[model samples]
Target chain A: MSGKLFRNFSFLSATLSFFLLVGIFAILFTYAQDAMHAFGIDFLFNETWEADEDDEGGVFGGFIPIVGTLLSTIIAMVIATPLAMGIAIFLTEIASPKISKGVSVAIELLAAIPSIIYGMWGLFYFAPIVQKTVGGDGVGLLTAGIVLAIMIIPFMASITRDSMNTTPLVLKESAYAMGATKFEVIKDVIMPYAKGGIIGSIILALGRALGETMAVAFLIGSVMSLPHRITDPTTSIPVLLANNFAEAQDLEMSAMYYLALVLFVVSFVIISAAKFYFFGKKAK
Target chain B: MNRLFVNKLILGLSTLSAVIGIGFLFWILITLSYKGITSIHWSTFTNDLVEGGIRNLLVGQFTMAILASFLAVPLGMMAGIYLREYGHGSKLASVIRNLSDVMMSAPSIVIGVFVFALLVDPFGGYNGWAGIVALAIMMIPIIISTTDNMLALVPKELREAGIALGGSKHKIILQIVIKAAKVGITTGILLSFARIIGETAPLLFTSANNQFFTMDLNGQFPSLTVSIYNLATYPDEASRELAWAASFILTMIVLCINLIGRFVIRNKK
Candidate 1:
């Protein structure tokens, strides 16, 4: 191909993400119109998900799944953020070079394991332990959230470590020369310097936890009923779609579309905020 | 003395946290291997799902993943080439870069939903093509980011030498710049391939699940991950064992590919 033609082709390929984003939004919005009109604003609050006797149409709402998604993600973030910070600190501040490198690889390998495996492992071994120690059935919000926390810890720690590693050695030495305690120096120097990236990594992990499907699917119990407690069974939007979207018909199907749209839009906003607002300036 | 105590306490807690992190990794791996190995049989590799073997699921998963790579690699590499070479420092390049980053983290299931609406809803039903498209969508952003970052690592001095040699822009990029970044790009490709192949959510609805071995793209296809999801939930010992076996194999494939990718880059260095 001619150079100009080749360049144009490349440009077209480069624009694919933008078009795909818009296309997904447009298609979901268009498909979701039936639900939008049928339930209107009440769809967010309506609790009962039921079909008419004919199996043709149904009254569907997103509140249970929406709340489930939010609560599970909140639980995950609360659990993950501190642990991830500690791991980052351990890797950057405490470990010797040789030990640090080996641990880093182990953490990355942990991250590489598929989400489905987490789900299976959670269902079998982890859930039983949770059942014995905690109060509820093996699968619930608490179980799902903790396993999800483990899943995202590696990602958050790696990114946080990268940013912490960027702190200048001279700055650290200056703090130490001033007789600052190790904790004090880290809290005063590295924390302030890498605050943006640290927060960015946390938010990014939050976003991942928000939309995670397989792991949460197995652990969340996939019940439509709202959870009465942290250990109670409930379903999230992705789980709801994964299990029910195919069998749904007419208005119920449209409601599923509406849920997917909400998920896509919320994640788009969250990930974009983390990228542009937090990491935008120093990302390169 | 109080300051020293606080430092020691915080340091101890951080060390405990790393231990907890590593502890979970070994816990899962050990459990997976013990269960997987105990359940494996000679027939496990020879039979299809209809006869209770994983041969078809493996083939099906590989077929879709490889086809996705075929679609994504060329398009993603071209996009990366545009970002680093032709559109360097341009307004449009920056915009695409940011969008691709956002796309990278957008939930995989939403991509499945989008593909279902476009390919499955209109085309009548679940098919291999829809599954491939959903996976391709997931793979493209990953490939784009990798290719972009890898190409950016090529030195400016090298490009200047190509220009001094009177090579065309495309020729220089194809022959010199891309060659310089080949190892990094290959590793990226391999890593992305591992990511997409392990995905269960996107294929959950797109390919649904087939009980029999079939190569037809117009019909439902077997998926190892999706089948594991279905089988694990079944209230039977046999199916549960199969699920464990499948999960072990899938994890091994993913982790091995990742190790190989790291090894390749380390060897180059």
Candidate 2:
């Protein structure tokens, strides 16, 4: 009887984290009620992000940060997807198995490298080089996007490779047996079958690019205004929260939670979609 | 043929693209080593951030990481065992499994906010312990999934062999399957550790940053990643150089962990 009870206890402990996630959403929602009540729809639409030091009323607007997050994520996805696809193709199709495994390990390590180091490299090394050519102070949206692209390439590439490789060997061989060239087989057979999964990887990459803080925080121009060009500096929602939360007082702190909430919800949708597609492939 | 030329061009670009991607990794490693290796002041491991030593922050960072691992490793493994051993195909298992995957990819900042709201809010300030909770939260899902996946890979034949000897479920799990999958579970734990070591965003809101030495868990504590951020953003050249050192240390630590983990996994196979 005691052993059975202990078994049940272990199961209960396992479920606690799922409950913890639910609790997080609840706590964030409750705390955000202040900003929710104050800003109402304006929280989602307003662009200005100012807060008076003593005002205590707190600033609450989502427009610029939301736009910045979306724009940078878009930039990252657009730039990373093709490069990732290229790497994935080369690895799966061109490289020897041993070389591919070595590169694969390298790519996996790339994904594991923490975000802060990437931020430091971008700020110190990549930004200066970009600044020289862009004709502006280089730490801006474009640089951030480029660094983000580099950071996410391994993730997208590996995912793309895995999904693409799932296309059956027999199918590819049959295409080859028809006198189809390598390009013909890839374009006609592999690409079509892997389309949904490749897309899923990109979406997952999008979620990553959106919530990333350290890497973009340095390179992206941290400002309140809209980025007029990719070269212009901007602040992502995560950046805003990171830069402000420590300094924020009372209601302002709650407003930052609202920003976290927004980021959380956006990532939730994209990540879920990506998981749905990527894992759902296995079920089939 | 025209098609052959186009194919060759595409293949060349793909290889070039892979080269560029791998090239960046080497470039960062080389640059970090070049600058950071020369700045090896033994004092770095002993000094406070403002005083130019990263000893306190490193301690604080590891304290949080170790505490988090202690918290996450068990619960995550339990969750994994539950999913694999008992709950497979159950509605609760499926929901939890999917949710765990989603949470595995959840934004670190969001998890920080969650713990900050849940723990820090009640305490009225940032402290080292709150950061531990946040970091632990991030580690849980990864460990859970890895535990589940690794334990599943333990052959059914092993379990049945133990069962034939009249072993209870718990005994079979603890004495047999867990032992078999020990290496994988350790790899998962180490990878999760590496993932959180250089984390800055979550620490930004939870532990915040401490410039001076303080070992107090419930109070503000110095942390390496946060210090790197603070140092890197400073306008002064000295601070930036220190930032590179910190980056080098962090990158090296993470790389070493990865190398060790990969080597171990390879050896296990």
Per-model DockQ: 0.87, 0.69
For model 2, the stretches where C-alpha displacement exceeds 4 angstroms are A281-284
TM-score of chain B of each: 0.99, 0.97
Label model 1 with its docking quality class.
high
Error of 2 at B238 (Å): 2.0
State the lDDT of candidate 1 residue by residue for A123-195, as single tens digits: 9999999999988999999999999999999999999999999999999999999999889888999999999
Predicted model with the maximum DockQ: 1
lDDT (C-alpha, whole model) for all candidates: 0.93, 0.86
Could you give the interface RMSD of candidate 1 in angstroms?
Answer: 0.8
Span of ten consecutive residues with least summed lDDT in model 2 chain A: A275-284
Error of 1 at A214 (Å): 0.2
